[model samples]
Target: MPQPAPAVQRSGGPIAPHLRRLLEFVEPGREDVCLDVARGRGPMPAALAPQVRHVTAVDAMPEPPARADTSGRMSTIEFGTGPVRITGDGGPDGDRPAAATTREDRVRHPIGPDRPTIKADATALPYRDNAFSLVTARFSLYTLGDPDDVLRELLRVCRPDGRVIIADLVRGNLAGPERDRIERLRDPDHPGTPSIARLTEMITSAGGSIRRLDVFTVERPIEPWLAGACDDAAADRIREALLDEVDGGPKTGAKPRVIGGELWFTQTWAHVAAEPIP
Candidate 1:
């Protein structure tokens, strides 16, 4: 399990400022059925649950199966209507109750009667066409090898008139590619971060009509940011690079600097909403 970072260091803190703006832009309604793809450990599900009719949170990895206690009652998470259902192929037979072993999963994506958490690939969703009113992917695209395919899938599962909300870290400046390099150092799974223009272009290329687009920057502390590293060596390398940048060795696009005696950097985030073009 990853150690918890301070709220401020983690995506502008809980209920992040950008997220609040996203919710405002979405204007979720009581009758809306939402699909949150590649939710990971973000707070989107919990934030949307209270406002929407139902929320289905999906991730590529499956949680351990949840078991019924001796009394016959199953342990349940608070957000959803029932126990979490884990599926390998997003098929009926693959569906089964799963228990979340990690503390992060338990708190961020609990299975309940209303919300059903599923394990399935984002490139190929398991839902029928135009199944949801709101389809969202938050901070998930940078990790995918085929983000374009995932974007198409998001549009496929979304209602024609519904919104597809995609929020991700965008390259801020000329050094943005360097920032991506550093991020990949921390987590090799990250393919690359995109510029705001590229992100919007992707939506259009995926047959989506852009409804709204918002971009903002957040300052993050170095230690907490490195907490998600693949291992100690990766974290150390990232740290050394940042420290070097701070010492004026070379510009890393990370914009590393000293803030109150702590190393900090900035990340530009882009939040976009689009509708499937018929």
Candidate 2:
């Protein structure tokens, strides 16, 4: 089985600050329907809800509930599947059990009082053509098995002239066998981290015209980075590899550095704002 994400760090909302800043490129407006693909609870939807008509946050995987309330002035819908029980005290979920969701299926999308969220795959979305005014995905492009196919789907669902914004760990140093080996160890699903140039070509080929590109780096601890890695061996292997890379004259692209005696890695991410042909 694939390993779970590293759990050694503090849990936070999914729409990271860097991602929120990327919003400037698209500059959402009122009367716009925004779809945040593969986006799990974060300030993104809540932030955009006021500016746009509605924001749909979709991700295939189920995530732990966010600690902070995402309830905006707009209506909300909390969606997922699991055992849902009502306490004797009347709560938001209800004073009654919902019979619509079968025991076998169990997967139920509960409607609530905030902006709606749904489960969906990036490549095969349930949305119709030209259904959204804006689409945003962060740190998802390079990890997919087939990024082009998913990118095309994102473009297809986007309205003509609508913007599709994506941010990912895109750097030239992330290429080559060494980087691939380390990434696969960290997350096997990670096919390859694409460079900015390569990502640009893919977006253009998928019928999108690039309008803006932003580059930034995030620093994080390697210990927490490997907490839920493929295995202890894989994690150890990656740590050793990173250490060796740092020891060597060429650090490659991983950008290993020591902070307060703890080892950290700098990841380069790129945000691209593009629009499909009208």
Candidate 3:
């Protein structure tokens, strides 16, 4: 199984501030319908709702789907927190049990008011074509297969003149050795991290007119990452897999030439905004 994301580290402080500043270009008012592709836990939807008529949160796997409130409107949707209770029989009153019957599938209760979440994939959206005025994928395109194809799909569903925005990690600024390490670890599905130039090419090739492109990085401490990785064994596997690269090429406790100081790795990201062909 793939490893879970590293936990949030308070030591590095909040990384969103830099991201929020870059998001200023996406005006909520100009949008009527918004779609968040790979909307992991719904934070983007909550951030976007006030600016658009409505927002749809879609993900490949939504552990516990977020439900709408009594009025069918939620201030936020706390998604990916954990599994949902199968309200029916397996456990009580003769209800039909859910497919996920194990304890690993369950988690603590939701904590905030949020929007609804739809379990779906990015490349194949369930909604009809021309359904949204804006589409945003924050730092998610790295793992997608054929990101250009994903952008094409986003454009396929976007209204003419509607916008498609993608934010992801960029590798342009890294040192030669660091860049080499990243390239080596990247798989086809992962595509490694992309540079701003590469990002622009992908969007342009997908037939969207580029509106704006931005580059940014998040500063984070290494401690929380170590802890979060501990949650899943796969994370340990990744650490073991990369030891040779990280430890200066094969069992050398000495640091790699790329990483010079206390800061382990610099998280790089990019954002691109484009519009459908009119």
Query: In model 3, which regions exceed 4 Å deviation?
Result: 1-15, 61-115, 173-177, 180-190, 228-264
lDDT per residue (tens digit) for residues 163-187 in model 1: 8988777774444467778877987
TM-score of each: 0.72, 0.69, 0.60
Candidate 2's C-alpha runs over 4 A off are: 1-16, 39-43, 61-116, 142-145, 173-175, 249-252
Candidate 2 lDDT over 1-278, as tens digits, reads 42332212112433433434555545777877888765334334555665678777665333336887741111221111112111122111111221221112212232234324565566778788998888887665543336788899889989886788886766654456555667778778676767768888999998888777766666666775676577798888788878887788555467787767877776566768778976
Q: Higher-TM-score candidate among 1 and 2?
A: 1
**Candidate 3 weakest ten by summed lDDT:** 86-95
Error of 2 at 182 (Å): 1.4
Tens-place lDDT per residue, model 3, 73-95, is 12221111111122111111111
Candidates' C-alpha lDDT: 0.67, 0.61, 0.52
- lDDT of model 2, residue 252: 45
